[model samples]
Target: MNKNLIRRTAIVAAAGAASLVLAACGSSDDTSAGQSTPSAVSSAPAAQGQHNAADVAFAKGMIPHHRQAVEMADLAPTRAESAEAKKLADEIKKAQDPEIQTLSGWLTSWGEQVPAEGAMDHSAHGMAGMMTAEEMDKLKDSSGKAFDTAFMEMMIRHHEGAVAMAKTEKADGAFPDAQTMADAIIISQTAEITRMNSLLGKN
Candidate 1:
């Protein structure tokens, strides 16, 4: 009878220890699951909201810069001599138009003023590699090979300016999306600049 009692007590103790082990594992799993979700949810808003002055400036400056580029691109279909120039111009418009809207959205969300359509004309002096009124007039009047040559040259300069601005954004901007956009600008414009140089036989 005594031996039987000892065996039964051992079984009960073993069962209790196994249940405690299972409960510990369950508790750890629940804790980890709970921690993961809130961290993910909180991070998204943090990324979206974390903008500094540099990010605001980058967005504002780039909007007008992109607008002027699109304007120049608009001229190419009618004025350019080469098929390549027209295609390149089309690509520029396609890429930048969407980006313009995105930048505007960012500005709106941040409570900053979206630049006016004609702001480039007033702000040209502050921006690098922007064409003056006379230069734009000259481009507008040109046709055939002259237009192609002028377009490529002017675009190369314009792209260089944009790349510089994007580099600054990458270095200083706090907003994650803005920094990403800056990276895209630097990569795309730099590639376009190289392509333009190759087309102009300067490569």
Candidate 2:
């Protein structure tokens, strides 16, 4: 064979081998890309998994309950005669407002309805420590020392009802978020109950 022809054939063979190597590498790259795409999609957080029915009920019920407590707190500054009573009311408002917002956000995120802005049926689920409509009406009418006593007593009962609801949530709720919130309510309200008892000289 001619030397030039031999050199040309060798060069063609080298080019063909290089092309095969590149094709193999391209195929490997395509498989890697395909594998990564599904992994990325699978790792995404699911909205449905984050909430359940128990969480929905807890958020819906708590929002209005918190709002009523806040209303009762707002009444304290004007109606309570004692500085201590006013301070307790302020504390209740400060603590509960954030929790209300938190629970409201949960309801919104879960696509659930917020509770109506009206009187709630405290007896609906056997919730204890709730004041009757008459008691609430009396609290609304009174002022000064009478207001202070009424506010404290009513709030103490309200907190107790909240505790009972929280216990129910802890027992039957499936969502971790609702369970965590229930735990917080139990802790905070228990502490408040102790404080209120001391203030009432019942401790």
Q: How accurate locally is residue 102 in candidate 1, as Cα lDDT from 0 to 100?
A: 97
| Model 2 bad stretches (over 4 Å) | 1-48, 119-128
Q: Which pairs in model 1 have colliding backbones?
A: none
Q: Top model by lDDT, which number? A: 1
| Per-model CA lDDT versus the true structure | 0.89, 0.79
For candidate 2, the lDDT comes to: 0.79
Candidate 2, after superposition: displacement of residue 97 in Å? 1.5
Q: List the residue pairs that clash in candidate 2.
A: none
Cα lDDT tens digits for candidate 2, 1-203: 69999999999998899668666766677777644654455555553356667677677777777777888888887788999999988988998889888887777777776666674755333445655668778888999988987788888889988898889889878777788889999999999989888888889
Clashes of each: 0, 0
The Cα RMSD of model 1 versus the native structure comes to 12.0
Task: Report the lDDT tens digits of candidate 1 across residue range 153-192.
Answer: 9999999999999999999999998988999999999999
